[model samples]
Target: MTHIRNIYCIGLNYVKHAAEMGNRVPEEPLIFSKPTHSFVKTDGNPIELPADKGEIHFETEIVLYIDKKPDPEFKVEDVVGKIALGIDFTLREVQTKLKQNGQPWLRAKGFKNAAVVTDFWDYPGTDICRNTEFSLVKNNETVQQGKAENMIFDFHELIKECDENFGLDQGDLIFTGTPEGVGKTEDGDEFILIWDGKEKGRFVTNLK
Candidate 1:
């Protein structure tokens, strides 16, 4: 079996997502981590949607694959590596309940196959650091859309915070975060994650 590493996730990086999450405005990037086993590859595989969990939602995000260990002062340029676009499957109802109860987000957000990533590619270009379009479609209907520039915290800052606490090593994957317009997905729901103009990946959830 393949060994799993750390699973890092950014929350409310996008301003619109923050608003949808009921925050007036994000003061800083919300960050979270999940076990590496949380990863789910969306390449024609069947995802078992949790029945007990209400309203499982799809959050399309750009995933970063680090190629080197970063020092405390590591700069984004120094952390040259691969970037893959993917989806962050979330339990929206559970997450909201947890937040209301002031509980941790793990149980709701860190289930098996919660993090879906694609084959890593070398960081496309510095332009990706600014505005890059990311979107998701379910059953051929557009559901989510937002640009990286809309993120309250940009890529550079996100990487700095990630390196400071987690210290990324080669093969470490970080989910930048999702945008607004998040909604629930059901069994047989075919979905796709798109970055810029390229089709990143697609998957369908299996009925419980």
Candidate 2:
């Protein structure tokens, strides 16, 4: 099991994604969270969608693991840890209605099986912070692609914001939002993330 103490998610981090979703590029990062228990095993365990939770959608993001407390004052290089490309699964209908009514939208995103992550890859050392890539391939075609250089709120900024809102500690996670091409998911769909040119089998989601 992947150990997770707290989960923090960043929304609208990618400028293109924000525009496509009809949102403005935020002045700062938009952050959300999935409960610690929401992380399911990707060690061959299937991703199950909530069958009754309206229409389920998939958003691919680059996930960060916090190794230490973040500093609002220190340079970004000092706070981040390992990285992984993960899915921030969502209930699109639930979210849209909530947004219209001005409600907290966690209920639409932070549900059981709403979060599933791949094994962590060590953060590209200080020399390489923005070269990482996040790609989601459905079936055989590339559906979404986001680069670190493209994030409106980069990892360091997100960590600072996350610590600002909730104190950060070892074992906390920060999911740095999704890129464009988010769409409804179907049963037996396999998502493979082409992370920085490397192929990682995310899941085929045996949704029941």
Candidate 3:
């Protein structure tokens, strides 16, 4: 049997995404989670889209792959660890309805193949904390664009918050959240996830 862990996510970490959602300035960072089975890796494998869902939206985020077991008495600065790259695929319509009804974001965010990630890489560097452009494209047309500097809670704070509630351990993943300009994608669309000043990865999905 395949081992499954936990999927932790940050909501509206990007200020522009908050504005796009018509939310007033937030008092604290928004948090959510997806099950371990939600993870998908592109090792020359095909990703299948949900047949029952409509207009699947793309939310490009910086995903951190935890490698250390969190210590109860650890300081926030000590949380530094390896991170992976990935895109957070969201069902916008479902998410909107859930929000209006004051419900949890699980159903809207935790579907199969909803979180697509790449192989883990060592923590890029401290500069990734200040400013880094992240974007997504479909068929060469950019759909979402954002910067890490726009996050309400930077990397350090994000890791701290996660540690406070749930102790992070090896193989755990955290999606920091997406930026503004998110939109829909039709079947047969080739999507690309790009992190500024780094390598870009591409994947194609079809509506089944």
Please, what is the whole-model Cα lDDT of each candidate in the order they appear?
0.77, 0.80, 0.75
TM-score, candidate 3, is 0.88
All candidates: CA RMSD in angstroms? 2.0, 1.6, 2.5
The residue-level lDDT of candidate 1 at 6 comes to 77
Off by over 4 Å in 1: 1-4
lDDT of 3 by residue, 22-129 (tens): 887667767899877678875555678786766688777888766676676654335546555677778878888998999998888898888888666667665764
- Residue 200 shift from truth in candidate 1, angstroms: 1.7
Candidate 2: where is the Cα deviation over 4 Å?
none
lDDT of 1 by residue, 1-208 (tens): 2233677889878778878878766677678987777787766788776877788888888777776777767766667577777777788888889999999999888888888776666787657655777788889888888777777777778877888776777767778888898887788998887777678788888857
Better of 1 and 3 by lDDT: 1
Candidate 3, poorest ten consecutive residues by summed lDDT: 74-83
How many residue pairs clash in all the candidates, one count each? 0, 0, 0
Best prediction by lDDT: 2
